[model samples]
Target: MNTIHTHFRLSYKIYDEAFALSQAAQCHLYLSLSQKAIRFAVVDTARNKFVVLEDYELITVFTPLQVAEQLRLIAQENALLQVQNWKLVRVAVSNQQFTLVPETLYDPVHQFDYLRLHADLNPLQHEVYTYRHSGLEAINIFAVESGVRLALQGVFENQPLQLVHQTSALIRSILHVVPRNNLRSMYAFVERSYLTLLVVGPAGLEFCNVFHYTSPEDFIYYILFVMEEQKMNPEQETITLWGDITHDSSLFNILQKYVRQIKLGKKPEDVEYSYKFHDMFDHRYFELYSLHLCE
Candidate 1:
């Protein structure tokens, strides 16, 4: 129940007293998958509350195929993931193979073309997918590994499933929680060694991109670089942090040294969480929890 494979370790888990396998028909399942980790959350739609959450950390880097194999093992062993009667299922893929295009200009036939500008495509290993963000008036064109996509589909064969990029979920949840008073700000969503940065203003989303870093220096460098390019004054503007970081962590410490106003982001305000979730960091599992906001 704790480890799916030798590499996939159950970092933590939380379950509400109200959660029951028999009530899956009234619940929604959200999954976040990446080379570094895989996590999932279950929400009871009837009460608009999260009932269960689990985080699995990969001890070492995994190829898409390896991740798929671990996911298969997880599906076979995890009781919650085995249920197919859920009201909704959404899986968010966290990776660098994604780009955003204006909704007005998006063409279904050219999804591949749009993504090619940002990432190389391998038909044998990757599959192209797109998600429309109505609130932001944009289309997120992304690639998911064929192996991972197939594994997810096979697990939920009897139910409808929506696959989205991790950024989509982050954007939806951040927009919902960030004050919309026309104040521009920066937000960071951290994962293993990957960092996703977003700049929002009165008009809407200004800039969004992801970076891969190996050290705290690399992490802070990207933030400063983006802020300069976006004409944001780090001294005056606020930068909010979420996912895989702590106030005392090296990442946070390095960021605080350069940015004048840095704060930790909270969970999405629109949804409710069970009391059991209070013990976990509110900013962690943000992308997974925000899957509820994805259409």
Candidate 2:
């Protein structure tokens, strides 16, 4: 019997000529799941280089089950995602239901308590989880929708897998490339309706949080609010942006109006990328690419 499957829109995709389905066992699979999109990338562990990347923009989905359905459709059509023989599978869930706790104060037994302080959680629908940042000595407390979590677990039932929040991945990636000068800098991971802002300094990750905005004004307002709260000067401090934004974008225009040093971040340099990805924007897919850096 032929089952009809509706697929999400593919926003961007790149594959190296050397990539092959037969090499799944020798590579790592990274999936970044969010309310508005699901992006996945493949890395050739043998050479420590990225070989495949695909981004799918999902239709508006309100429930966890609806997001799971969209994921299933994309997996059914994606040859790379259908394989279960990857050397490692890491999934990063992107949402606002997350918080950062200092390592010394983190209590695994109280994961729910740590996260509930920052966001409300529906025990039946959302599962609280924690990812330890070894380098920064912190614990990331976040929630994942049960349906989506179950769907991914079912997909790679026997394969080695790890799950983390998208903000965790972004923080890991940002710290990896934080300037040697150790200057306090603001990093913004922009999405369609939200952005994850992080302030990293010489000591390590100082602040991390997600903000939802509807317009350009709302976007800059949050940026400036964070700056004022952190005592960062708009005319002197630098803010580097990444993810779903461009130089000519209205969001960028508004950002430049207030911030003096506005820079577009590049992909992580710690890992290599296939030449096919050379033409792609460096700042885009910062979370998806950073999954490779996650344990």
Q: On residues 1-295, what C-alpha lDDT tens digit does candidate 2 reach at each position?
A: 8543454699888999899989999999999887788889999999999999998987766556777888887777678877979999999988899888889998789989888888989899998888999988888888998988888987888889899999988988888888756689999999988889999888888889899999999999999999999999999998999999998999999999999999899999988999999998899889988898887
Per-residue alpha-carbon lDDT of candidate 1 for residues 8-103, written as tens digits (9 for 90 to 100): 889899999878999999999999998888899999999999989988887665587878878887888899889989898899998999999998
After superposing candidate 2, which stretches have Cα over 4 Å from the reference?
Answer: 1-7
Off by over 4 Å in 1: 1-5
Each candidate's TM vs. the true structure?
A: 0.96, 0.96
Q: List the residue pairs that clash in candidate 1.
A: none
**Winning candidate number (lDDT):** 1
Alpha-carbon shift of residue 144 in model 1 (angstroms)? 0.7
Local distance difference test values of all predictions, in order: 0.89, 0.88
**Model 2 residue 152 CA deviation in Å:** 0.5
Best-fitting candidate, measured by TM-score? 1
